[model samples]
Each structure stands twice: as C-alpha cells, then as structure tokens.
Target: MIRRVLACSVALVAVCSLGGCGTLPGFGDDTTEVTVWLMRNSASDDFVQRFKHGFEQEHKDVELDVRIQEWTGIGEKIDQALKDGDAPDVIEVGNTQVPRYAASGGLLDMTLESLRDWGSDAWLPGLAQPGNVDGMQYGIPWYAANRVVIYNKDLFAAAGITKPPKDRAEWLADTAKLNSGQNQGIYLAGQDWYTLAGFVWDEGGELAQEGTGDWKGALDSPAALRGMAFYKQLQALGNGPRNADEETPPQAGIFAGGKVAQMIAVPGAAKAIQKANPRLADKLGYFPIPGPTEAKPGAVFTGGSDLIIPRRTAHRAAAVRVVAALTGEKWQTDLAATMNYVPNKSTLAHAVEGQAGTAAMARGAAQGRATPNSPQWAAVEADNPIKPYMTSVLNGADPKRAAKAASDRITTLLFP
Candidate 1:
C-alpha cells in the first residue's frame, strides 16, 4: 500500500454543495444516500459487495453508494472534495494521510466515537497513532500490512537450518551460512528503507523527532548509527545492488530464480513470485523479522488504509454507521480473510492465523510504527534522502559523515 500522500500544507474550508441524493440508482425519495470513496485494490469486489449488502440490509432506509478510486492524483482530488463539497460521506485514506487532511479542518474529529464505540485501545498503533492529530482522532483504521522475512524452505533445508532464527544473532549467523556458492543469503536491496526503519526502531532510534512544535532529523543519533551499522553488516551477505530499491530489479523476480534464500517483503509478494515461477510455490516460508531478543520481533513500518468522514457530509450519522460496520469484527474478519491483510485490532490477529505468511506479518504488526506525523513528512518521501544515505554507507562512505548529510537534508524538509 502507498502510505504517503502529496504534501498539502494549506488549510481548507468546506463550501456547501449537494451531497448524495435520489439521483443515485435505487435511491427512493425517503431514503438517505451515503456516498463512499474506497481506494482501488484496497478491498476485493466480494468484500465490498458483502459490506454493501449487509450494511444496506441492516439500515434499509439508507443506500450505500461505493465508488472505487485510483491512487494517482487522489490527494489532489480529495483536497478538492474536502474544500469544494462534492465530498463523499466517507473516504478511505492511507493510514499516514490523516495528519494532512485533519490539519486542513475538513475532517470530523472522531475521538469520542473512537474511544466510546471503537476499541481504540486495541487498534494497531501504526494505524491509530497517525489518525490522532493534536490528541483528536480523525481517521479510523481499516486494515494493515507490513514487511516480513520471506524465506525459501528448500534452501533452508539444504543449508542445514532446521528452523527460522529466533533473534538477530541467530539470524545473522544463519544468513552467513546460507551466503555461499551463488546463493545470496537475503537479497535485501540497499534502498529498502522501510526495512532499515525497522532496524533503526529496534535500536531505539527515530528517523526524526518532534520537540515543542519543531521537527528535526535524527538519523545521525548514536542509536541510529548503530542501526545503520547493523544494516551494512547484513546487507554484505546479499548481492543486491547498492543504488536501487527492491522494486528497481523487482526482488520477487530475483527470488523466483531459485538462488536467493530470503527477501524482506509483504506476504503478497510470494504470490507474485509464484506467478513468476510456479515450481517454488510450495517451497516458500515466512517468519517475523527477528529483533534484538527472542521474544520481540523487529519493528516494521505499517502501511494500510483508514476511513475518515468529511466534515461537510450531509449523512454524517450514516457515514459513521458505515465506518462502524466495516471496522466491526464480522466485516473485519471477512476483509482480512478475503484480502489477506492484518486486521485493524491486535485482538483480531486471528483473522489471518490460518495463513502462515499473514500470521507472521501479524506478529510483526504488533511493533509497527508510522513515519513522522508531520504533514511535511510527505515532502521528505517525495525527495527521500534515506535511500541515498543507505546506498552511500553501503558503498564504503563514512557512516557518520553520510548520516550527517542525510540528516541535514531530512531536517530541511521536516523541520518547521
């Protein structure tokens, strides 16, 4: 899932316009129509149909008009809707996008509902934290996805590894053993910054920090340097390019070639790998990215969607009902099962327990975190310095010097 939205710094005020009404098909004069905008590929047609059918069945007087949206230019389109009032009653935004929209004053503050009705306490922190802007809840988490270590079972067996490593030490040692004779141990790209973020988080280092309304890059912090050191060490076991990301060479294709033993990616990447090479379908395996200790998994950057209501929606109450219905256990279970996503709440992790890949992703989702809540964070990603920093350090640049340059760039983008 694409979690970053284009930077929208200006605040927006809603202008009234006609909301969803009788023009929609099957709309009756007495019926209330609630329009919803859901991102393309976010949910399957079956899941959407089930939700529409069940929601409308429960609220017979209400009509649910769900529109699928493409990701391209969605941020601008949403900004226009929020400002000009053609706004859908409910909109599904990326989990990290809440801060930008909420800052524009066009989203309803759902803190009360989140606390009283929704199980806010049990929601994944990665999704929930970004939704809370200045202590007010504006986004409702829908589902989550994160990266995990996807390994080749056949290669592991051949390498004499009986089970996946339990911690970083065992992981490093095992990876070293597997990094022999044309087999890249992990095939981790130098610019896989999300994976790097996990290592940084595991070392108790942050990419950036907020203090008294100002943000500063912390990539040069002592803990962060240690994280980079670890990344450099592990990256040496792979032959992945130092200048490119996983997608640049399409890591899935490399893994499908049957030489690489492991790769860090979403569980769904396995499907692509299988499509590319069917013979290895049953040879795949999954495990949470091991952390510093046995009981803890490495932290991961969570990517997913969150449902939010436009402040200008005429069907505020109905929109709330729609969100509640979708995030509820029955629909959540169906969505997770149908789409293979981690459920919104930690307690509902069982929704994907039957699938090994998704179950491993769920385990890591517990320690998931979001990028900086600052709306300017998108600007940082737009001209991401972290990627080059990783590449430079891997290419023998001084860690402190390379980190300082990257940190300086990040500060320029993120510092208010």
Candidate 2:
C-alpha cells in the first residue's frame, strides 16, 4: 500500500510539471523575464494586474515584473533608470511626454513591420500619433481619453434654451440665458491648454504649423483675436467664473456641484463628477464642441497613455506580447466601460454598452490634432508669454499688436 501511494504521488507531480503549472518560462532555461514600468494610478494598477495575470496564464513560461511609479516622479525616475542601466523592458508614458522621450532616443524604434506583427493599427488614427517622432513609431496606444462639453439638462430647460448649440452664435446666446447670479453658464479653466487649443483650432489658426517647424503667432490673427474676444465676452457677461485656475479641483468642482450649466471636461472625469454628486450620474448630457462655423467644428484634444518599449530591454518579443494583450479588444472594451475612457482600438466598441455619448466623443477625437510634438513643447507651454499678452487683447488691447507679440514670442521659442 505504501509503494502504491508513493507511485500515485509521483504521477501527480509529473502531470503538473508537464503542464508548466509551477514554473515561469525562461526561469532556468533560456526563458525571458520582462519588466514593465507603469504609472501608479488606481486605474492603471488594476489594468496592469489584469493584463499580467491573463498573459502569465497563457504564456506560463514567461515572467512579468511590474514597477509602479507615481505620476509626479515618472519622468525623473525614467531618466534615472536609463542612467543606472536598470530601465524597464516596457514603459507606459503619457501622450504628451512620448514625443520628448522618443526625440531623446529613450525608446526603441518601432517600425511598420513591428506594428503590423503586433496588430496595433486597430486603434484610432491620431490616437497613436504621439509615439511617432520624425515618422518612426515608438509606442502603441494603450487607451485614449478626450474632452467634451458636459451640460446640465435641467439648467438648460430652466433657462428656456430649446436645445444644445450647433454653432458658435447659438452657444453664446444659450450661455447668456443660462447665466444667473447664482449659476454661471459655463465653467472654463483660465489656462487650460485643452480649452484654449479648441478655440485656437476653431478660428482656423494653429499654434504651430507642421513639417516646416516654424512658429507663426496665429493667436494674433483676426480670427484668433475674434475668438479670444468672444471668450472674454463670456467672462464679462458672467457666463464663466473669473480667476479660476486650470489645474485645480474648483474648476471641475463647481460644475459637478450644479453651480454651472456647462463645462468642458475629460471623459475620465465622468466617474469623479458622478461621485461628487450622485444625482448628476443620469442628468449629464454630452455634446460635441461648437465652433464658429459648421465647416470647422471645434476639435477635442486627445489625451492618454502610450505603451513604449525601451531600447535596453532584453525581452523584446515578450514585451511586444504584453503590449498586444494590454491594447487588445477585450481589455480596451472593459476599460472604457469601467473608467469612462474611449478604447484605443475602434473594434473594441462592442465591449462598451450604453456609451453612445462616448462614441460621439471618440469621433471628435479622431478629427482632432495633437499639439506640436516638438521637444520644446513643454518649455513653450510652461513659459507661455502668450496668455498675459492675450489677456491684454481681451481687455481692449489692439488685436494686431497682441497677435504680433504672441507670434514673436512663439517664434523665438520655436526657432531658438
């Protein structure tokens, strides 16, 4: 009986070993261990865990090492990692920062062949544009988010507005009626790049033109001057708050608190807004941004994380697999529903249910353009001399002089 029991135990061990149940691939043999560096946000953590578990279950021979870093420290950490020779195999980077890293040779060169093999083109067109520097791909879009106009239906009804605006004129008129001593019609972040960029684009003016790498001050143009004037008009008429900072909670807080009728906000903000005021969960209505003319509908700026492979990685093949699984249809769809973000891939639409508003927002994102992908983009935005100068124009400064001053400053930054 003892001999029979021992034999049965040995048989069970052999079965388990054959299935590769206990060992990760490339552990003892030539198996690969890939390290993934991800942001330390709550949503990102959940995504990383789900992706790691799923990939590990399928590819039992592979080992995944995940390192989470706070968003504030990511840039410094990545720079330090590269110098220390401890760079991760794969990295998750913000869309805006992707260009800076790629331009500095901090990422692997992903060619069309690599993208095709990995099947990354399933995402939206401009969604993955950030990972490309000088037309060579360096990253895959993991997920995407964009801004939209969220309005209170009850407020609109109370203000006697028949419907949401389709053009700039109607938008202004509606805001005028919605404006009350207790409630502003719109909640605009004063220095919000996303909000400013929408107005800039609507006026047929670009912050910077593509390819030539020239910076002409479009902010001083007649069209841009007109747009800025309109913006100040709203502020003067009490349609929006004064002295609201773009990066703080109060901008979104007031809107969520039912003190404002309409506001420009990100898709990811929906969950937070609903959390702030539970009653707002079903009362929110979404609409595409209105522009000066139907021919030029205002464009929503795209914002999201990109999946990049580091040049120093030893597990290139495995890293590619990880990116594929993360950006796959199943993951994209699941993430969109739970996080209120749009999926990177167009095919993942079916994964999201009851999200027609998000779908419309996605279409707007596709039509949008990214800010100049130059390495100097950060410096320009940080040292934006244009804002104060534009403020002068809004307060009755000469339009041409304001445009020229802004243009000159931008040109110096771009060319210098």
Candidate 3:
C-alpha cells in the first residue's frame, strides 16, 4: 500500500497538487486510471510531476494515478498483489528482482519493437539484461548505481598517502600504512555482493554461466578462485565485521566513526556518511576502485531500479507510453543531475560524468558486469549463501572448498 510522503528533498522538487475524482481538468468519469506504484526513493517529485503532466497530454482519455510506495516489505507486497490480480499497472523493480517476476509470468512481454521508444540502444547492458528473460523483454532500464571508492582525505594524508591507489596492488600496499593504531584500511562491507562481484570480474572470473538453458556456477574456475582469494584477503586487511550480511550496511556507521580509510559504495553513501557524522563532510573524497590495471577500475556490478508493467494491466499500451515519457531523454537528464545517480541510458551517463560519484562509477561501469540473469539468481540473493561463505573463508576456510560448496548450493537451488 502507498504510505508516507517524503518531504521536499532537492531544490527543484515539484509540488504535487492533489486532484479529486471529479476535480481533474479535462478528465471526466469516463477516464481510465492507470495506477503506477513506485518506491519513494526511485523517482523525484519533479520528474514524476513532469511525467504525470506529459502523459496526460499524450493520453487525454487516461488519468495517471501515481502512488509512492515504501521499499520495506515491497517484495512480499508486490508478490501478493500480483498473485491476487490487484497489482498496479506499472511498477519499478530492483534490477536483480526482475527475473523472479518475469519468470513467474507477472510482467508483460515488451517486445523489441515496442521498446525503441525508450532508446533501447542507449541502455547500459548491465542494467538492461536483468529485464530480459528467454529473449523477451519484461522491463526497461531505469536509473542504476555502481560502486565508487568513497574515502576520508584526512585519513589518507595522516597515513602519508599522497594519491589514491591506481590499482588493487597499490591499494593493498597502502593498507599497512593506514591500518595503524585505532585505524583500519578499506572498510569492506562483507555482505555487499556488488563489491565482491567487482573483484571476480576484475580477475576475469564469473560467478555463474548459462549453459544448455541452465545456469551453472563457475566460481570454482582458476580465475574465480583467484578472485575469491582476493575477496577473502580484503576482510583481513580491514577491521570491519566480517560476518555482516546485505541486510546490514556495515560501512555506514563505521565510515562515520572516522577510522576506516576507504570503502566501496554508491554515490549516495557520502550523503549518508555526512548525515551520520556531519563533521566528516568536508574530508570525504570519491574515486573508482582501481582495477589490477592502472588504466581502468575494477568491474563494478550495477545496482538500480527497472520499470516493469504487469501482465494483467488493463492498459498495457498506456503503461508503455507512460514509461517512455517518464524515462524520456530530458527527464533522465534531470534524474542524473538532481539525484546523482547513473542514468539508465549510457548515452546520457556522460552528462553526469563530471559528478565525482558518476565519474568514478562510469569508469568502473565501462568494465562492469551484471549479476547472472536468471530466475534462480533472485533465490540465491535471498538465501545470501555467499555472505556466510565469505565469512567462513575469512575465518580460515580454503577458497576452493568454499567455492565448491557455494557452487553446489547454487546448483541445488536452481535445479530444485
């Protein structure tokens, strides 16, 4: 259910005027309502306002009913609603969650011809691939987030480091200097799969690969084993809790506490850190997590929302139009400028490159990879098998054993 209104955030936030059933101008009782449910943080008021106004102009016979929904319990809520045939016309799903819904036949099949309106070619492959299932498109690329190294400049200077690490080896070299009394090196949020995926991709390894219409876990490969080793070494280099899960953002408070040297996170983390400890605001810095090579950063995994339409929607055509207008080139540009997020359209990503977060993220995204696109991937995430496995490895388990067990668990989940 739609609950709570987040007060004005950005300066250009549009004021939404409440419209009663019969109060809407030019819309009458015959007007069909297209209810759209979106998480409060997914879109800005100004962008939604423009979409509402613009869509109305295009479809005079349809009334757009926009509701702000909370992310908490959203998965259960959407699942229940969709199963009960009471789902909204259009909803935004996390990129990773698209598989679960699409594979379950909950979303409408948006064929390639129907998707050109949204500039399909402009989409970042990592952001768009999750929206695809069995060659059919069920979602469109929405705004995305990639990791960028957010560090404390004061800590770096105190540690005698004059420049950020150009590569992972350099980063590891600086850890000794940073990990002194009361201070630690990079604050590796142990539960963050996206950050871990970067190391795997950097080492030319993959978590899973599709074969014979099924995804097989490939973490046991030589390259992946190296990646796993590097990932485990990360925890030992830091002082943060090694047993944390995705449910807990371990870096938030720790970074604010003013001892951790660096952390890999979305651009919004800087805001969160400042909120936790305002005094550290000016001392913060941002950059991409350098890869093994000096020319590029590690391959960061993309995290963002994707727009999907329910199969049972009474207005599929209207929903498509609405999404196209909402994610229009102009609005997307505004989304990046105002929200500090990477636009779904890579073409527009350049516009936001000047922003430190987007710049660092863009550098990483050029080499980034999306999570394996499969329905079972969602189940794997919910189970969080890797977090525990990582914890075990950090506690002294062999990388090969942990990887093999993880692969077994994944295959069991996917097959069962």
**C-alpha-based local distance difference test score of model 1:** 0.92
List TM-score per model, in order. 0.93, 0.82, 0.85
Taking the tens digit of each residue's C-alpha lDDT, what string does model 1 give over 180-221? 998989899999999999999999999998889988889999
Runs of candidate 2 exceeding 4 Å displacement: 1-30, 42-44, 118-122, 180-182, 210-217, 221-223, 226-230, 233-244, 247-249, 268-281, 292-297, 356-360
Q: State the lDDT of candidate 2 residue by residue for 1-416, as single tens digits.
A: 99999998798778767764333433345456788877766255676677778888898767888887788868777777766766888888887777777765767787764467656666665566666778888878777777777888889888888677887788888888888879888877554556676677667766665556644556766666666666666555443433344456455566788878887776556677788899988878877777776654576677778888877777777887787777777777767777667788766755543785686576566556567676667677777866666556555778678777877787677664
Which one wins by lDDT: 1 or 3? 1
Ranking by TM-score: 1, 3, 2
Error of 2 at 248 (Å): 5.5
- What range of 10 consecutive residues in model 2 has the weakest lDDT sum? 21-30
Model 3 gets an lDDT of: 0.78
Best by lDDT: 1
